[model samples]
Target: MPASGSVSVQSLDQFLAEVEGRAFQIARIATGCDQDALDIVQESMISLVTSYSDKCESNWKPLFYRILQNRITDFHRRKTLTGKIFAWIGLKKADEEDIDLLEQIADPNADMPELALSKDRFSDALIHALEQLPARQQQTFLLRIWEGLSVKETAEAMQCGEGSVKTHLSRATQTLRAHLEPHYFSGDHHES
Candidate 1:
């Protein structure tokens, strides 16, 4: 945990393990595809190890997130470019691949079915709400609030000013709260 020395292999492995789930979640929220998200997270982790492993463990969090953010951006750009090129060539994409993530993760190995079901639904709703956010807002909220990074660290990871990070987080929080409050807190569902 030195300020400048490279982390040991064990420490690096532990760090990757600790952040893997959240990283996957962040990438998933960004990509909206389970396989794409997994690829982005893996690429980000490898990029971090190859490029920034020489940095200190203390620096890894922000650096790894920055790499992740860049990778997500790159993924989107590539998708867009590929789509345009395909259209130009008169080639069309395959059928839509909308994945029901809830179904994909429904069978959690939890002993308490009631609690697990409720928690899973809420988590799913939260993720859906997150998907509705703008890119900057989503990244800011994930890095600053969900991932427990400081404002300064989030700013660094997002390549934005601290004020921008705060603004994005505020907007994202309000949007998510408005989206999820009624569904979770109301006494009755307002089914349309």
Candidate 2:
């Protein structure tokens, strides 16, 4: 209806706005700390706006995710290196800040009674299972399943081959099933 360039820009703006919340959530999952997640998401947003704004709208999803993934990986790398150095110098503390499992679990609930309780359990189990997965598998599962990206789009976002994405997704799904089946499918409140 409008000029093509104007339409493209408008769509891009809409796309970014829609994805921003999800991107922050994804970054938060990747980074255990809230502050780190916020920083990573902000940097990724800036990078995407500056470098990839000219990209086709169709290609923006994968590009934005790839940038987010790179930022997450960079944060992990820096943290790992800093920890190593601190350990080498005997400056690292014996007890690090423990992430509370219950607190980390998202409560996807409202004032509803039965639905809230059941869904909360599932959400907790899902987040725990996801946290146990390797970084690549976690990324693949989140991109492919949670985000509903195609295998090709996931591959691009992960900077890997399609086969690799499939492999990682398969492994992640199997691991999640193993972790969740006893509690969910069996109807048993097995304490892990």
Candidate 3:
């Protein structure tokens, strides 16, 4: 086929191949459902191709991350609003179980035994503890610590001040520490 534009299909394929896994990881954490996460990633890919394909390649990472985060936040807002409306209509109970945000934010691959071999019960507890964190805190923790993004990059992706990023990360750390204190510092815990 004749070339239609300056941005070649090869370049787009390369970009998608490089970032697809991490994009899915971020979406999974943000949405808590694998299928929803996949949808967000796919949508983000479409948006990137449609709107920003002509931009310089160096700008792709932040632009993609920003789009992904916005999509995730929108999904959460819609879900929350719908739940509230349902409750108001007496179609759902107000006392329904709260979602574990931290568990939602954790990378699914991290659950593998190669990373940590905690008993199934301990792993389940940890997932529960993570789910209890606020959305921003969980995002901060995952982007900064898990994805290894710098503070500035994380702030940009989150569309927040650096101070806000630090605050969220600090609060997330404290909450996780408190939740894991008994296991983390106990004598039974072995240092690798």
Candidate 3 per-residue lDDT, tens place, 97-185, comes to 43433223355657565445444446565655666788889778877887677888889989999999999999999998899878755
Ranking by TM-score: 1, 2, 3
Give me the displacement of residue 136 in model 1, in angstroms: 0.9
Per-residue lDDT of candidate 1, residues 1-192 (tens digit):
445455678888899999998898899898888889889989999998998888878999999999999999999899999999999999998866857553344455577666676666678789889999999999999998889999999999989899998899999999999999977876333222
The TM-score of candidate 2 is: 0.84
Error of 2 at 79 (Å): 0.9
- Model 1 scores a TM of 0.84
Task: Assess the local accuracy of residue 41 in candidate 3 as a C-alpha lDDT between 0 and 100.
Answer: 89
Expressed as tens digits, the lDDT of each residue in 1-192 for candidate 2 is 656553366777798788777777677778776677778878987898888887777888999999999998999899899989999998975644645333333445566656666776787788778888999999999899878899999999989999999999999999999999886876633333
**What CA RMSD would you report for each candidate?**
4.0, 4.0, 5.4
Report the poorest 10 consecutive residues by lDDT, candidate 2. Answer: 98-107
Count of backbone collisions within predicted model 3? 6
lDDT score, candidate 1, position 90: 100
Give lDDT: candidate 2, residue 15: 85
Candidate 3: list runs displaced more than 4 Å. 1-6, 93-116, 119-127, 185-192
Off by over 4 Å in 1: 1-4, 96-112, 188-192
